[model samples]
Target: MAKQTIQLQLSGMSCAGCAKSIEKALGGVQGVTTVNVNFANEVAAVEGDKLNSEQLVKAVKDAGYDASVIDHQQPEDDSRERAQQIQFYKFLAAAILSLPLLYTMVGHFSWTENIYVPAWLMNPWVQMALATPVQFIIGWQFYRGSYTALRGGAANMDVLVALGTSAAYFYSVYLAASLGDHAAHQGLYFETSAVLITLILLGKWFEARAKGRSSAAIKQLLNLQPKQAVRERQNGETETVDVAKLQVGDIIHIKPGQQIPADSTVVSGSSAVDESMLTGESVPVDKHEGDDLTGATLNKNGFLKAKVRKLGRDSALAQIVKVVEQAQNSKAPIQRLADRVSAIFVPVVLLIAVVTFLVWAFWLDAGNYGKALEAFVAVLVIACPCALGLATPTSIMAGSGRAAQMGVLFKQSDVLEIAHTITTVVLDKTGTITEGKPKLTDLEIDLKGVNGVTEAQLKQAVKATEQQSEHPLAQAVVQGIEVEALEQINDFNAHEGRGVSAKVTLSEQSHILRIGNIRLMREHDIESDAWSKRKDELEQQGKTAMLISWDNQAVGIIAVADTVRDNANAAISKLQQRGLKVVMLTGDNQRTATAIAKQVGIEYVFAEVLPEHKADKVKELQQQGERVAMVGDGINDAPALATAEVGIAMGTGTDVALETADIALMRADLNSIHDALFVSKKTVRNIRQNLFWAFAYNTLGIPVAAAGLLAPWLAGGAMALSSVSVVLNALRLQRLSLNHRD
Candidate 1:
């Protein structure tokens, strides 16, 4: 059989449940073997022999959500508008009916008693006259929604609400028409039914608004890329073209303050690009000819002509949108429990309600049918699954929001949930734990007749030689130099993977200053014992040594190394205190990795690992029965980041690093990692607490209401109160503080 794959664009997914709905919808299609729907991206990937995308889209549409083939992606604006219109109409109709129903129940004039109004005008027929259309038109959706859930063998909050309120109002109308003046007005529950639907709709409206805001993260990311660009024409002139139309080898002109339309390479001009939106870097990166640029990064200053390399869905912005969407839509481990409960919740609740009515009316011999009916209403009202429906999403929104505020942007709640279980943290040495760039840490000088040269003179020589080199150590030497009279040399030569050499005039005496590694010194035939001794000492101290040669003799040595972040020690200690094992993974030699690891108090170190081997190291840790989290801040770390149980990227790192990570730490501080974990643990705990309260209230409270300890009026009030309490408890997470405890 030939393999088949079908793609569909889906909508109406506010949480993982929606994704599951889409998956179930597609899974029901004939010949479909698997259905994977990413709610975050609103895309579904289906596989099977003879699977049809059109059939899958129709199935999704029948589930009350908009869907179509993947190639016909709906505009975000149009989707939002449709969602808003549906919600607004439902709210408007519910509100319009609720107002009059409320006034009739508790008004200045006694309409039910017929004191201010005539018997015919105040009759039960009149109330039903006004309420029947309201029930069918405004409240029918809830009833239908409940009916659908029941048929699917699932129970949501709607089932409890629809059954409870509808029974009360419908039973009251039957009593009034049959018993006439002897009928009890108290049994007329039309107002309660109308008001219940209104309140629930109000809650749903607020939920929809909050969900719209939460889901906007992906939309905002998508909006970062410009819609169009000025492509350099064949005649050397530029003509504006749609970004979607851009292809490889097309030269585009990007101006200062404009967003780059596609991932490309600079062919001409120089500029500093602000990549904070994508990379979370505060500083603008200097870009010259040949520098690769990403779509969505702003050209902060200057102008550049770049050849378009990757565009459309292949661009970085589009990839980020896709990842974020997938994460948001994917189910977290905890949500599965809710799904199981919902699958059988309605039938179980209905059975309990029927049994309660029979036990009260027949077994217990309550007053009459009215008493049994009251018990039935009480069971339905008090057994609402609002708390169950609210359990996961409220915690997710609060947790993800708090994480974002703490500089940890979780692409999905699943990542936040998994972070709590991480036992071992595998960190890349270059950027995860330490500043990746080399910086001059030590400088040594030895001269006889010249009296020791000033630090300023040594800096001048190193800086002049390194001005033309892009090597990490050379950049460090250049940054460390603090001399006023450093002059640029006309002739400069840089040897790849080695160092640089240049001639400078010192006191009118021409001397060649060559700066590079030990290999560069040997190649230049520079000799000096002092330089070797200094190099050995610095290396023992976990620093890289750069030999400096002057006129065919080694005159000095500059020590350069990637320094560990200031808060690394404290962060490591905190992680250990929390019962987490800290491990270091690095491409550097064992000596350097161990020396740095010892300083930071890490007991385990994986050294000399190439980029390709980092992911394997992460997998090895997992095989040891450890839940691992890999922390990194480079493109090379992308594979490991994706491989780990949880991937954390430093916010100050590259775009590729941030994109690949499950969680992006906004602050570069290692301590934030500790803080993020702390927040996740606390958030998960809060979710459990909220779930407990929600479940405890329904499990215990429903029995009390059915036992007639509470009136129907009181039961309605209590149900609303329980929902509010659960919401307030979830909000408490926002108040949690993550300051240093020790």
Candidate 2:
């Protein structure tokens, strides 16, 4: 049975340990095959054989987190924004309440003692009054989180905060209760707990703001979708309607500078359309009658009446957005180590905090209970699992989002991790390295001694016969045949890779017409004879030369060539510079394949290999220890694409090829190949840098805090900074650019 994937938005995840705890709970559910809970995005992607979304959500709630099913088609209702706003208000309240405690704190320190403190601020009643609300009210979230965590048989950052702050707050409350003792005011540590909460709230507020910018790419894409379109009615009138109301068969009118409403075909008029937002190609593409128009592309000039081919999720833009969203939610393989560490992060920190108090109070300091409490609080607040959790997902989100902006979409986080290791790049010749469209370039005719036949009649038979074949070269021949009338064809047959043949009646007589290579002519007991030399000459020029025959006699030869992309050479040069071996794969004959390969600076070529054998070649290279990345844009390329280590499909490719690919390049040229690989390498590097620092911050920090080197408030602030810094480093990927020559 195929697995079903479900996404859930989670709440109450204060740290990475919370994310891991929820993952374990969901995994215990029967039929759950895979679970990936992203701390940065606050989303859980679960794949199961027969999953119930409600059941999954219940499991999360049981693990101390709240969850609800996510809807892909609907726009987000901005619940995250509302949550951030609520946190901001809480932070403001905490800061305001903690200010008086901070003011009195200066009196405790010797260096700031000269600064006057209000005599009333030192009263025990005043100290308890200022710290109570900040402790129990503004900091209630930590208490609730701690209760839920312990009840669920797990621990998180909340447990530490609640434990440490409550110890200081309740201890100070005991000192305040003894109003008869005047020394109680000096013993009160209320400022420590209150000030710690204030710093933590400030840090969380900054971290939330940075995390918001990491997912900005998806928002930019969502904003690109036009909400409204001009629909043409049957009564010859145009009416503006919501894009959601459009259907597959609807007729839409596109005025100058208006966005195309849906994936449609232009039935009337011509214009230049800017598809830069989708393809990352800055130049405007010319669109004429019968050309396909993608939705969300700007029509630069002229009015067009188009018939919609696809709408909603079936459209190209929606699919691109879906790819990006799925990639951003995926977890990289390196995240497993982080998850394992986070599962026990809080418990380990809690143990260390207890050890610090024992060592400082009983062993080193002997009688100093106050100094031991400070060390214990510092140890509890300094160790952060949030940084480790945000490290990988934040980088993946930013990198994939930036890749999509450059017209490259990684289908999953695993692809982003693996694409940088590709050693061999196999490019399809016909449509990948060269423009998929082949225009008619040269056509020559020699009617031989076939008597009473005009060149036009023979050409008419050629056009009618070639029109039935879907081969690019055959189409080129058909378009080049400028005859006003076409001859009727009978018994037309297409030979895969060789050529096409048919029976045509011309000049009131029936004749056999064939168009193919010299081998096809020889198979039929006919030879190109005089045209053989010309065929070799055309093949030498990277053009496919076809031998046309009538009644077993050579009549003419037509040469069609596919132009190489303008940046093909530059892209190949860049790849070779990076130590990647570039190879060309094509069904075209050796001579033509070699010619095209030479033009693109590729030293290796797989010529005359049929479509079925494409996958075999990729496997053979893989067996030879080559990590292959197959790039193509046709139905024949799908098998090979799926066979390679990384399948890169051009956005202009067929649906089957694109769906089979791991990375989809929106641009129609090979320059995106360089861009995609560049982005992958840079993103992986960024992830590594983030992971290193996140680990180092915790590893080096916990010891210092336990040794009493950091103040409790400073420790709380540092913990928050660690997570924010990792996310900020990941956000730098959004600004990465390879400066493509194209």
Predicted model with the maximum lDDT: 2
Tens digit per residue, CA lDDT, model 2, 292-366: 998888999889999999877788887887788788888888777887888888889999999999999999898
Backbone clashes (count) for model 2: 0
Model 2 Cα shift for residue 359 (angstroms)? 1.1
Clashes of each: 3, 0
Give the per-residue lDDT of model 1 (tens digit) for 163-186: 777787888788777876545354
Model 2 ranges off by over 4 Å: 1-3, 28-32, 49-52, 178-186, 441-468, 482-532, 547-558, 653-657, 738-742
What are the Cα lDDT values of the candidates? 0.70, 0.85
Candidate 1 lDDT at 356 equals 87
RMSD of each: 8.9, 3.4
